[model samples]
Target: MSDYLVRALAFEGSVRAFAVRTTDTVGEAQRRHGTWPTASAALGRSMTAAVMIGAMLKGEDKLTVKVEGNGPIGPMIIDSNAKGEVRGYVTNPQTHFDLNELGKLDVRRAVGTEGALTIVKDLGLRDFFTGQVPIVSGEIAEDFTYYFAASEQVPSSVGLGVLVNPDNTILAAGGFIIQLMPGTDDETITIIEEHLSKMEPVSKMIERGLTPEELLFEILGKENVQLLDTMPVGFECNCSKDRFGSAIISLGESEIRDMIAEDGGAEAHCHFCMEKYNYSVEELESFIDEINS
Candidate 1:
């Protein structure tokens, strides 16, 4: 099935929740970046959480998530919009290590134990909303859970997981975010906590082929979850030759002339999707002419 996200209200609207399946989306990322097992897990987990966060926004709104830990993987950057389009990359795509004590992909070791999780939101306004917090846990889920509570002052539980195949491709990738509104009663909170404590890992659930709705029902119970909406999700990059050309044009005529003279061509590389755009000498001259015109 195609990747999609489901938004739901539970406990009579006192709690908000989101769940998404990102297996195909993350597989695309692995193929694009050639991430190793550990790096795939780290990047996939971040993208899963970021996409859910993006669902909280409205039209034209978007957010960028940065995981700058002091690990071998360097850092990860993920961008997502309300439209369910997400793209991301890691500074070191080939980083990997042996499994941790739990026999899991050593994400904490790959992501380091120090640094910050930063999120910048574009609300289509004059000022952007930026929230940052220290990495309480190198594991992406716990870090985001802490981010929501400490940075946004919203009590939340974030469950994210990514399983990598033996061939360094994505096996399953998905997550869920549950938030408690101000008036959520203690009983409801206790019940949700109990459910979470007993539920399977998010990655395992996805590997078991659970749909987003079934995933929520597994966590929140069928009677308690009220599905609000669903939207398709995938790895989508906004980069293009024209977009890169516009950037080169903005560099002004002098820079364009230098590119034509020194290299006879220019290339722009997108970090998110690893796609490169080449500008030949003639293309550079046209940009110069466009700038002059």
Candidate 2:
């Protein structure tokens, strides 16, 4: 089935919750980028968390997440919007390492222990928001949790996980974000802590075919949770040949002439999708004419 996300409130609106199943979505990214196991986990977890962040926006509002670490995987970039569309790519898609002590992908080792996680929100009308926080743990989720508390001042518990197959395909990918609101009673907090501590990893739950709603019930308990609307999620990239062409045109008529002279043509590639757009000599000349006109 295609991936999707859910937004709900628990503890009578004192806690906000989000969960998603990203197996298909992350799988597409793996196939497109040829990511290794460790790198897949790193990028998958980041994209899963990003989908939740996108759920918080409305209409044309969107956000970008940059996970720049000192590890082998380098920096990962993810974009998402209120519509549950998310796309991402890692600087080094083939990075991988042996499993950690927990017999899981060594995401921290691939992601590094230093650097920063930065988020930028384009809210339209020149109302933009930027937040940056040091990467406390290269485990993707912890870094985002830290970003929430330090940058957004939101006390949130974030769990993101991705399991890879022997052939380096995505077996399971999912996440959950629980945010505590003001006036949440101490009793509720302790209850949530207990549930999270006893539950299995989020990825395992997803592998077992638990739906997003069930994932929340596992995290916050069915008695205390209130289900909200769900949103369809998928791996979607906005890059197109025309968009790249326009970018080439922006390089100006003189630059187009140089391309036409030296290489005989120009090629543009998108980092997000690894799509290559080749402009023949004729196309280059047309762009020059368009610029001149």
Alpha-carbon lDDT of model 2: 0.94
Candidate 2 to truth, TM: 0.99
Pairs with backbone N, CA or C atoms under 3 Å apart (clashes), candidate 2: none
Put down candidate 1 lDDT per residue, 38-70, tens digits, no spaces: 999999999999999999999999999999999
lDDT of each: 0.95, 0.94
Q: Which ten residues in a row have the lowest lDDT in candidate 1?
A: 284-293
Q: Which of the numbered candidates is closest to the native, going by highest lDDT?
A: 1
Question: Which runs in model 1 stand beyond 4 Å of their true positions?
Answer: none
Give me the displacement of residue 189 in model 1, in angstroms.
Answer: 1.0
